[model samples]
Target chain A: MSDNPQNKVKIEARDVQVFYGEAQALHGIDLDLNANEVTALIGPSGCGKSTFLRCINRMNDVIDGCRVAGTITIDGQDVYSPEIDVVELRARVGMVFQKPNPFPKSIYDNVAYGPRIHGLAQSREQLDHIVESSLKRAGLWAEVRDRLSASGTSLSGGQQQRLCIARAIAVSPDVVLMDEPCSALDPIATAVIEELMEELRKDYTIVIVTHSMQQAARISQRTAYFHLGNVVEHGATQQIFTNPKNQQTEAYISGKIG
Target chain B: MTEPSNPSARKAQLAKRYRAERRFRAYGIAAISTAGLILFFLMGSILLSSLPAFTQHYVTLDIDITERHVDTQDLANSDWRALARNALRAQFPEVSGRKEKRALGKLLSIGSSDDVRDYVTANPSSLGTSIRLPLTLSDDIDLLLKGVIDRDLPENERVVSNQDLAWLDRLLDEDRISRQFATRIFTNGDSREPELAGLRGALVGSLWTLLVTLLASFPLGVMAAIYLEEIAPKNRLTQIIEVNINNLAAVPSIVFGLLGLAVFINFFGMPRSAPLVGGLVLALMTLPRIIIPTRAAFAAIPPSIREAAMGVGASRLQVIMHHVLPLAMPGILTGTIIGLAQAAGETAPLLMIGMMAFIVDLPTDVTAKATVLPAQIYMWANNPERAFMARTSAGIVVLLSLLLMVNATAIYFRKRFEKRW
Candidate 1:
């Protein structure tokens, strides 16, 4: 693939190893995430794709007996350094989940929670503006604009997933990590999320871990194929899919192996 | 496994399975109805036994409050009993002997003087005027009037003797005998006389004790539960603590009473029979009960909510306070109220802490020596007096009503705030 000025590294991860108790889940993974681009990690179950995505925002810290050892940096600053405040780090690098988890609160409050906690808005009008723009960017404003006071859970599955997206971007984070954000959604809902991601990539760095190879092919500029806790191939999405690659990557894309 | 090759055999097997299912359903109905029947019988008996205690027999007489008997300056020390005795003697002029006169005097309660005093105190202008005052009947005469003593029994077997019966009949014929609501049972405090014994002291003590229990246990229990569920690491120490908590919930309540007696009373020198000490002991007993269910309520919340909050840059405390705690609140409140209800009905620990004492005054504060409802009921049940039997049942009814109200509040809150995740 030809290089462009837009392809600047936003996140640099090197020799990242993850473990649950004594069982290692990821073995020395190296990946570079570009600014303003969607990077998709595609692999079978237990392939360490989701684990690697969580390394960016330190979401795994809450889990017991889970540990990560390596260097993960955003804009050349180490995320795992003792100086990094987790709360602030998370605000800088937000995350969306596999299932739609909206707080049992009004749609407006759900979207405004991020900004309120981080003191991003000085006035109610500014907070409202953030909620509106975030919802619009996620393509849910038209459906939910009139009923922002209604509970976010009252929406349909697809709309709820969109609401979660809006909530994540409400804080204006630099990077958004989504872990199989479409797994619990239907295909139509999944397509809406994919399109939303495509639009989101223009402003924020996006990293998604998905089981769907087609989703990786359609939405991502760079794709990494993982198997058995190891990355088998990493390149431009088109080359990884269409051109010759490693034997394992070939077998996986051909549906002969996972 | 042998496969049924014929449709008829398969149909027969299906019929057999249906019959088994019907039998199982019948067994379930039988079990539930059995429980319902027992509960109905228990409540019915308590209500029936308490019915007579709700009303009392009083004899109204026109007694002249002369200026000579009542010292206008010192009404508190006035000889009001003399007035009641003279009024009774005037009603029965035919009886002249001392033995017969003493027997007639037993018809009125010993506290009848207080009744006259209270009336005179309220109506100071009525001095030197004839006012009709209703005097409380003694417990024996009351039981006789209510037909609980069986008047037809032989003179020796009956509590109301022949002379007492004649005077009571004379009073009844003259329209002096009136059955009124037993307001004294709720108005006055505990007494040696069953008719004068009231539940006010016990009620106040129970309220104070439960207030302390709730204030002491609820926040502590909830915080301990949160720490164990969300903050504590899963290791041998926590595992031991969890196991002990479960074991504490099953320990005999008397053990908690002994601990209170030793620690709060003997070591700390806290007042015995005080609601504060009783409440603290009960709080200790109820802590495990509250914590166990609270932990369960918290555990029932989905992990996704916590993750959602943390993903949005919420701190650990923020994740629990904003998302997990609200979702788990209904369960926590229900557990806490149920534990409190159990604590309200608990008697063993209180008895051990000296709350079974015969307290005559309403507890003024948590530190005052007082007796709770269950302790009062236990003491009344042990009394040999016949009227005390009815009082015990009445006390049980009050305690049961309180428990029902608390449980209803639990249900109401659970229904009101519960959210489907």
Candidate 2:
């Protein structure tokens, strides 16, 4: 892998802390995600890896009594400032969840929802192109082209997940976050999602939280290992897996401890 | 593992479990049959009492219209009162005294001469002809025919005098009186005459009132539910509102009647007996009925849907408007229909707002004076007329049918969308 200095930082988080009521979930953390790169966060259960991923898109703001204290910037623009419109920020940064949840409407409507709300496509032909290309990029167009009017929930678990990915990218967001996107899928379906992620990294910056170490090694350019609300190691995937600096990272890779 | 090794004990345990299941099934069947039996009893009683109201008895009479009975120059303006009394007297030649003649007149309906006048106006050329007309029998004779007033009772306590009862018996023996199915009960509107009263006014008023209730409550209730359950912060204010909604559903419906009398009739200056005012008042009462269940339905949806929509860059409001609403639609519609059924049967509120009026014509518009089914039935039940008893029962029958139709529609939507979504 080439370490190019020309690669601009897409997201920067410094000393990030998250709390739910009186209980703190995430300790102070510093990490930078590069453009056109896939960064994977991996840890055991209750390690706050998913919580950190949620902070990037501000999805946790909907929860009552939950607070986040940190400076999170996207392309040097402050994401937490009062001047920032949360709705527009969300349109710029999209997400995919672990369970495949498609709207109870037609597949075309599911993909067109974001674009229609934001007035992204001026004409029907433009919206048609956006939907088709988004599905094609997600590796679901060829299978679903004949039945574009079918309900998205009618598809299989894997197809629904891909449809969600297509739905997320329909508005052309610069950053996409996935929270254990393949955890609910079978091994074969997991393989298909991993393959799709490989192609998506060329255009949009992706941040994924996964429990499977093999998935982190297979697709990510950079990996961060979390242990009990703290990130213990961060570097290239190859270097971290083969020759890590911390004993916890080494023991985690060797299966001595979670 | 040790328990399975003991075969005798295991067999006994299985037998006991199967026996318990059988007992539970029997209890369920017993409960359902009890409910069905009560419903059958209620419907059967109402039908029995209401059937007689749709038929009436008539007596045929013949009388020669003399020159004095008709003003031939302006024949169309002639009244039937003098002719009808002469016709009754001509049938019974022995009645000569004034008091006895008046008692004889009581055997015929107060509305009988009006019927004779209709016939004369239709055929005005035969002014001096002798016509045999079937006239409506009065309530005394009607009760006598139905055996409701006992002939064995002393004349002083009965609805008819001894001579009048004997005359009615003679008319029955001669086969001059006949029973015919009453059509005016279906064609005419509310009236002081019980035999001519109909349910058309109340039926149409309920139709319009329900339309207004649906228009004002459905969208407003569903939207309010969405806001409270999905968007509004769960703080003390919302909690207080939630508790009050629950209390509203349980509050004496008369409280809403008072509210309507205060807000809609007095404060708003709306027409007192108009369906428009009645509908607005019912909508206020029905709002809480629908909103509580709608919020429960929204709450029943899995949280994964909200999470999924949010993940796709949808705002909180968008998540509810686009995703949550479509899924919970069938439940919301069913709740709205149940609330409407409750509103259709609401009497106290309507009575408070002056819907208890004797309306003789179908209300042509929302602003016109109107009466609802329950209020109309209540008025008829309180009337002293024996004929109105059957009419009141018939109104109940019609009201039940309307409620059934609305509930059936709710079932249709429930079946259509419950599983599809």
Candidate 3:
């Protein structure tokens, strides 16, 4: 491991392995997400990119017979420590899934759910402020401000994703993990989400898993390519796409190997 | 172009297929209608046979109660039986003539003093005042009024004596006895004599029993369902629990009644025929019914919403409370209402729990002797008086109407809360 003192790492996963019953999903993988930067994990289907993302927030715990091993920490705090409160750990490291899964509630309630559950907002006005600021940070307030009480599901696909982003940020999490956040979106919506991620990196550490290499090139500063449950290459996004050091990475970018 | 050579043959084939399809559809319709017809006929027969019970014949009398008739001194001394007898003799006005008084006394109910004593004790101020009391007609008179007493039948086949029928007919013509709508059937309690019985006491008992069943079963069933569906770990134990719940739902309701009899009535030593014990038993029988549907409702909730909540940094408890529970509410309510309906119709379990008790008075509390609607119908069906058949049918109507209301509410709630996602 190279000691880069100037780079402030928010999350570090060391030698992580994941399995679904006897089937190994993610091999020993090591990675770092720096503060105020977008790190994208890009790969083809079944390459365990999404599985690794789920491991960061321990979302894999919900899957039957799925086990994750090795040390994953956020700001030097072991997320899987026995004393760690999963609720609090989730509060600190939030996630956004592939599909825009808004709660079956009004837009306002969907965004305010986290803060209310964590007792972060003392008054209704404070909760409203949190919702507004989160939505604003997600670049959705301008489009949805007039209908905050409308159902979150009433929004367009892209807007629902942004609302989910706003909901994730509402709890003031330090790191935001997204798994194929724009897979279900149209081109215009995908561009909007890509842009939002760029802006979101200024205030939050963002780790995104995407199938679109162009998306990785457009928004990500750092990128990791995985193949067959192993990290093939990881470096600055431009270098990995333009001049990858590994043959597998080069073949993948050249449309030879997925 | 090629088929043009065989247009007639193709047309004939298509016609044959259409005929087969029509026959298939007709069979489906016939099956559905057959089931519906059977249900309709059963209900129709029950209503048709019990219509006569709603009307009753009674003898009305104007009796003068002088200070000497209902002796205030005897009543104050709690000599209730003497006061009741004296009041009965005064109403006849034949006590001066021993033979006439004896005949009048024979015509009066042996238990008439119980009514007098109840009335006098309830209103002590009316001891010396004149009052009009409508005494219930004898069971024989009631049967004759209902046309059940066939005087032309052979003596062995006839249950009511010819003398009594003749007496009743003469009294009816004299206007001393008359047929009136039996409103008391809706206001009085059960009795050994079906002619004197009503559904008022049973209705109250059923209402109280259902109240307890609802209060106990709904929250507990819903909570257990939510936990099992949304929170509980997927393991052998949970699997066992799920299987047991499904099995319990299919268990014969009478088995639950037997269980109640053994555990609640016998082992617990709870008051026999009390709504409290009955409600507790019914709630147990209803729990599996409620829980299965509620869990299914919760399970119908897509995992995407749960993931969304967790992705938003909300805890599992928060996800369930804020999102899962609300979405599942409609199903939960539908299940609960259906369970209540099932419990309402259940007679076997209630019979096992002593709801067949011969309660002669309206229950004042949950612990008092009571009879539910089904049990009341059962009792009325066995009455020797023919008039009770009508009352039983009327009771069945009330029971069916209540079941319909509950089912309608379930459908309404299911429609109202149905979610697309």
DockQ for all models: 0.81, 0.51, 0.55
State which candidate, 1 or 3, has the greater lDDT.
1
Q: Which parts of model 2 have CA positions greater than 4 angstroms off?
A: A2-6, A254-256, B1-5, B59-107, B113-135, B143-180, B204-220, B262-277, B357-369, B416-421
Candidate 3 clash pair list = B50-B389, B50-B390, B53-B390, B53-B391
TM-score of 1: 0.98
* Candidate 3 off by > 4 Å: A1-7, A254-258, B1-17, B58-68, B71-180, B415-420
Chain B structural similarity (TM-score) per candidate: 0.98, 0.84, 0.82
Candidate 3 lDDT at A255 equals 83
The top-ranked prediction according to DockQ is 1
Candidate 3 lDDT by residue in tens digits, A1-258: 122346698988898899999999989989988888889998878999999999888898889899988989899988888988888878988888899998868899888988998999999899989999999999999999999999999998999999999999999998999989999999999998888888888889999999888888888888999988999898888889988999989888788877
Give me candidate 3's TM-score against the actual structure. 0.85
> Order of candidates by lDDT, top first?
1, 2, 3
Arrange candidates, best TM-score first.
1, 2, 3
Worst 10 residues of 3 chain A by lDDT: A1-10
Instruction: Give the per-residue lDDT digits (tens) of candidate 2, residues B235-340.
Output: 9999999999888888887887789899887898888899888888888889998999899889988888888777666777788888788778888989999999
Q: If ranked by DockQ, best first, what sequence of candidates would result?
A: 1, 3, 2
